[model samples]
Target chain A: MNLTQGTADPRPANPVRVVIVDDHAIFRSGLKADLGPSIHVVGEAATVEQAVAVIAEQRPDVVLLDVHLPGGLGGGGREVIAGSAALLGSTRFLALSVSDAAEDVVAVIRAGARGYVTKTISGAEITDAVFRVAGGDAVFSPRLAGFVLDAFGTAPADIADDELDKLSARELEVMRLIARGYSYKEVAKELFISIKTVETHVSAVLRKLQLSSRHELTKWAAERRLL
Target chain B: MATIPVRPPLARSSDRVIAGVCSGLAVHLGWPVKNVRVGMALATLAGGAGLVFYAWLWIMVPTADEAARRNARRPASPIAPAVSQPSGPGAFAPGIASPAVQAQGAAAADMTAAPLPGPPSAAGASPLRGASGSSTADAGQPEATPWFRFRSMKYGKEILLGCGLLLVAGIMIAQMLGVDVPLGTLIPAAAVLGGASIAWMQLDETRRAGLVDKTKADQAGGWARLAAGLALVVAGVLVMVSGSGSWEQTWLALLSSVAVLGGVVLVLLPWALKFWRDLESERAGRIREMERAEIAAHLHDSVLQTLALIQRRAGNEHDVVRLARAQERELRGWLFQDPGREAGQLSDRIKAAAAEVEDLLGNAVEVVSVGDAAMTEAHEAMVQASREAMFNASRHGGGTVSVYLEASEAQAEIFIKDRGPGFELSDVPEDRLGVRESIIGRMKRHGGTAAILNTGTGTEVRLRLQSAGTDAAEGKP
Candidate 1:
């Protein structure tokens, strides 16, 4: 929002488009009233299901998401929360949860929410989160900040690009198939290549890498971060 | 001292017809898994790369770490190697006979000579012998196929992705041949193919067979992940291949980056997790077996000592028979677990209390309990409560304590009652240690109640817990 307010901003004369995704109608109305005239409220969704629908429909820049309701995940709707997280596109999810349980709190955060705030948060803080989320910044409360940091604190594994480079595109594909434990014939069938082709690839990979066997390929792949 | 550490120039895995020995050599010698894979691809494209290292690594590196870590993980032998006093045996040397185990001599020496860090239990790799690699489904006159599909719930998705890729390839080929095919038809076909592929993975041979270790399987899963990634990469490459019509062609580069990164993440991340998990589980199992072995040895020695003492003390043959009977019961429980395997996995407190009570009596006895269900916090509390009740009943209540618990729908009700002269319900003193501390203490923690209900009909103590089923469902994901 501050970026937009600075007259030197390069964006065309468009408002910061927003979508309200709270289960509570009253709060949505209150949020709209609170933001006043500058921010444009493009859509409203009452549950996670509806939120998804509105997101796909409006392509909203930002969404104020409620963490739980009657069924928790959404309505008893079929388009439910899933493991892939593919369906959640450009629209960022900013959670409003009443729970402080670390597991519940952490789960939603991990599920691609750009911001997570307890229901106890004031409207002012929520507005701040909305602005930050719209600008592509991650937002969380102080306690939650620690949780996020801990969750992502893993040291970046130094993958041996060299080990990865050893595989030809086709051989890499076959190796990946093999590492997935694909049998020679199955891999041959899958690649639309011959069973002999699969065998040849496997043998070559084994000899070239000095892996000893298929299992070492697996171990080496993991250690050098290739698997 | 001034020499460089020379790595092998080529990977052993890249060359072999069955395995990529050459690429493996290349990688070991500071090369790439890709280079090995590609080299193998070309070698397969030609003939096989000379598989010089295939026979070498197979012969050279240890076959399975299974044997290497077995002694380290298992409990030491019962008969102390240092004190070679055999229990009238011929081949029962001071040490066990294992050709692979010169290290056993050192381990045995360390065990007898050094103070044990904790228990007689061995440390790691106890369960390696158990996680045999072959699947049971491949038993009998199995057609030794060279292919083994990684066990995955989302194989259908992978297949679908493959189909999608093929469909796209087909469409592109058709377009090149100047034959028109609608993308609308192709896209849906791809989607269907992806789903079918994932389902195929689920029913694949490796998953259905018992021979494959089910504890670990392929980590990659979920819908359209590979498809999405491949699509992105393809789109990016296409954009770059087409010359920049506009400076906005940078969008193609951005899209390419996302696609490549996403595909790599989806494809590779799961493999990494599975590898780590396999290593962890292997180490854990080896340690567990060693522990069990040590326990078995300890129990054997303890039983022998007790039986000898009982034989010496018994006044008559009849007395000897009775003492022998009791000793037999105790020894059996120690060596082999009861039906449920509970007595074996019991916590120390329960074991200690059982021993203490049996010690108090003229006859030494051990009560063993095993769990058929997951052990949770509430279950542990209940187990502790049972120990307390058993102790109180034998010592003060003057009767055998009978315990029965029924659990359903997350609620557990435990009945701990003794058959002694039932104390008056009202006279149950608030400060009386057993009734006050043991009975009420555990119940209150689990948001439940303990009461001395229906007294004189044997002091019937009923504990009603609403959430004690937590411990019963422990160890489940």
Candidate 2:
């Protein structure tokens, strides 16, 4: 759980501002209690409409979002991210859900969520992921890594290099290790690299998953409804 | 087959023709009913003896209803089973004791019993009409008046009657003007018109009923009526053309053409019915899709949120968390999965295996499978080895175990890992067969490879196998 302590800075004087956007009141309160003293709960929302409104009003450093919600075009978390697009630069969204659906994970990411984490994640890890997302770093949980691998992990010679649709060799290694439940620190140690280098590879893969225009990637994602 | 202690008391069966006397006697004597009916008819025709005997039997024997009441009081006599007569229509006696049989008899008596759900005018037009029309061919129930006669009817029936009257009036006026009218041609024409109108009414009735009940039996029954009506129309057409006294050669040609057209309609009728049913099912599916979102919302609001809360509260309690996780997975599968698509092969297997491991060890096992191969011996070995590796990870290497299985057309690979104190394979005792025989040796025997690696902080077991049909790895050994 303290895998990121060495890389992350000490808790600053001003706690990281966060807004919880889950439809469950019990989950929201439980998460708020488990988040410890390092994070400040600014606001909460249970639906897409309220999420957008609260995110805009609070202008929190990070927004913990549930992937499925009740209102706003029925797009759930994606609609919220799209609605709060203006605030994305200042207020990043870190999707926190109990759903492991690839389509939902990819949809929120494509709509500009910085990362996605399942609710099974421990309070310490979630708190760390929030800090990282707020600090403009991509947070890849093991499930998200698996999704990225399914989308981009392929043999090198099979696809032309010009497409840039597949993960790099190093990125593939990072994703596989993560998918195998290795923390970034553990992955770095296994590969004889620094945790910073591991983060860089993961962030690159996340970017490709979000903005790739290659037909193969689009076709692959579309086939699975990940797009 | 088993002989009863007592025979069914002699009584007139509800299934009666001419007071059911002959049929009841035949049933009591276990003789063919047709023999009895014929003998009675012959005796009556010859010397009036059958009439006197019939009158005596009719007075002496109780009706079926009274007999049923008598049996109810006694409770010792076994009710007679329904026996279908070998020859005569409506000769079978339905067992009065069984409610199911009674209800079936009632339904057969009135095929149009179900209330048609639509406009009041349409509903009122046809229940009795359909009953009478179907009864002539279907149930052999006696009718007070012949079904063909125009009777007190409404809506569609009145429209049909009005049209018939108008045609008759025009023909009468033409005849009055001293024109030679072919009345023979008008008769067949009227028959055709009547049959066509009957068929059209049946179609409308079926379409309206389909909206409410949507049961297969109802639709099938409706189609049968429609077919009967259409047959009548075709029969009328054949009669008019074939019965012409003059122009024999022309009549023969027209009859051949009509036969060909009839064959075509017969072939197309089934196809048309199928197309109509497909359109109906598509509309049903669309309606279900609309309701799906509403159901998803309601489930997500209460059940899903509760499961999520349980998982969150049971963070470190592995058993509670695993139970919650399994439930959530099941709930989500129900909520979003389409009706007929196959759940993926290796992924489903791995998830099932993971669930078993979680149940056994109370440790979470995260599994993800990419691509899929046909389930074969090689994939079976992979799953077994994966399960073994996962079991080892949960027992020895603690914390959450992660399993990643990637299957391609040529090969399949699996990685089972756990974050525990790293241990070397050489350090394991020789007595331990779980890793040596089950995980590593199992893959090797299946023309595959396995490796156990120490990841400094944890242990990982990797297994790979070639697809069964593919010979890509055959040349290696």
The residue-by-residue lDDT of candidate 2 on B1-477, one tens digit each, is 112222345789777898999888888878788999999999888769798678768866878776654333211111110011010001111211122223323332233333422112212212112101122122222211221111122145557667877887898779779887886576577667676766666666566445323554375556658666666865665676566655456556766887998789667866875787687667656665655566667677767776777767775676566667566656655443322112335555777788888778878787765544445676788788889989989988778888887665467778888888878889889999988999888888888888888877788888888865654352110
TM-score of 1: 0.26
Q: Count the backbone clashes (under 3 Å) in each candidate.
A: 123, 0
TM-score of each: 0.26, 0.58
Q: lDDT of each structure? A: 0.45, 0.65
RMSD of each: 31.5, 25.0
lDDT of 2 at B68: 58
Report the TM-score of candidate 1, chain B only: 0.34
Candidate with best DockQ: 2
| Candidate 1 lDDT by residue in tens digits, A1-227 | 12222212222345657877676888878878776354689998776566666667777766666655433333211122232145455566666664332334344543456656655455655666566556554544533432221221112214532342144456545543332223344457668887545545544433333322223123222322233
Model 1 chain B weakest 10-residue run by lDDT:
B85-94
Cα lDDT tens digits, model 1, B1-477, are 113332322323424454445445555667665675575567655534323234444433322333334433433333221121111100111112221232323333333333433222211111110111111121100111111121132244446556766766787779779896664455445445544554555445334332333332332222234544555555445445444554335545656777998789657866865786697777667765776687677766776777787778766754564456456545533432211111222233344555555455423222211111223566577666766666665565564444433332245444455546666546877667776777677867756666664334345556655553354232100
The parts of candidate 2 lying over 4 Å away from their true place are A1-14, A157-164, A214-227, B1-228, B231-238, B241-319, B332-344, B468-477
